[model samples]
Target: MKLRLGAGGTLRYGAGGTTDLDLPGDLTGQVVTVDLRHVDPGSDAGATALLSELIARGAARLVISGTDTASARALLASAQHDAPPSGLAA
Candidate 1:
């Protein structure tokens, strides 16, 4: 199964290219947890985008769980480094 975070804070999860569910909510100032254990390797772009969007939307923190935790952290760090400055106070 693959989990995708949509533009409008909707979570899409499914298998075989079919989205089976969408859980919608605001992510502002929230700590979001993402599990990427089942995600394919070498798909860092999507994960990076997700991290960027989360930070841009004011997520307080992120908890990433997967087989490649180190890589995930590195991705998040890169995303944070490349993220645009936000109006929200740190």
Candidate 2:
């Protein structure tokens, strides 16, 4: 995966591995968009880890978008059912 710094200071994640997607920098007020088209989160742990990691960084919003709406829904469902990130209220 790759993280691109957008013109508006938005951070975008392209398809890739954990190393590629690792927090590129402190999020602060940045908005993060994870391009999930080819993202294969095989298990709940993987999904949770992905979401929690992004959330923990303190982005204004972490947007997971892809061509596959079904996969997106599943990912969202998994996140909702699992434990929330540390800074977020459950």
Candidate 3:
């Protein structure tokens, strides 16, 4: 089975074709972990939106785990570019 972040940041899970899975509404002060095992590398649009929402909603921490750590980290990093300004720039 493969898990991927589909369009609009919807989580898709299953083998062959994927199906949308409902994500939690609020992530405030929560530690959310996203599994990216067996997922293909592609556009990070959905991931970016998800990361934005997680940050906007005050998620305590995000743990990305999977066989494809590099791709997962890259995906998260891409989302950082679209994140809201936090005045952390140099």
Candidate 4:
């Protein structure tokens, strides 16, 4: 997990190539920017759970890169309403 600090103390987290992800409990309930580029999220228990945890963290914006996989695209779709304004694309 990589964090990008932004204006107003915003915490942005980038999770790249997450074949094995272990999200810390402390990160829960904290709004964060999640970048899942090049990560195959399908059926990965850790990845799926992490995504849900991020969403529950309060409107975390999800960003993806490269050829969008179905699971990755689903992640993008889940946050599409926030995409236009947040500039988060797949």
TM-score of each: 0.67, 0.50, 0.55, 0.36
Clash pairs of candidate 3? none
Q: What order do candidates take by lDDT, descending?
A: 1, 3, 2, 4
Off by over 4 Å in 4: 1-43, 65-67, 75-90
> Higher-TM-score candidate among 2 and 4?
2
The positional error of residue 30 in candidate 2, measured at the CA in angstroms, is: 1.5
| Predicted candidate 3 versus true structure: per-residue lDDT over 10-87, tens digit per residue | 587555436775655555667766555434556455666766666555666776666367766777777666766543
RMSD from true fold, candidate 3: 5.8
Worst 10 residues of 2 by lDDT: 1-10
The reply for model 2, stretches above 4 Å from the true place, is 1-21, 41-45, 67-74, 80-90
In the range 1-90, model 1's lDDT, one tens digit per residue, is 245544343455554324645433345667777666655667666777777767776778887776476797798898898766665666
- Top-lDDT structure, candidate number: 1
Candidate 1's displacement at residue 86, Å, is 2.4
TM-score, prediction 4: 0.36
**lDDT measured at residue 17 in model 4 versus the true structure, 0 to 100:** 31
Candidate with maximal TM-score: 1
What is the full ranking by TM-score, best candidate first? 1, 3, 2, 4
Q: Where is the poorest 10-residue window by lDDT in model 1?
A: 16-25
- Over 4 Å off, model 1: 1-26
Tens-place lDDT digits, model 4, residues 15-50: 433243355644433455444433443433434444
Question: What lDDT tens digits, residue by residue, belong to model 2 across residues 1-90?
Answer: 334333323345554423323464456566666554443445334544555555565555656665367765676566655635556433
lDDT of 2 at 41: 43
Candidate 1 global CA lDDT score: 0.65
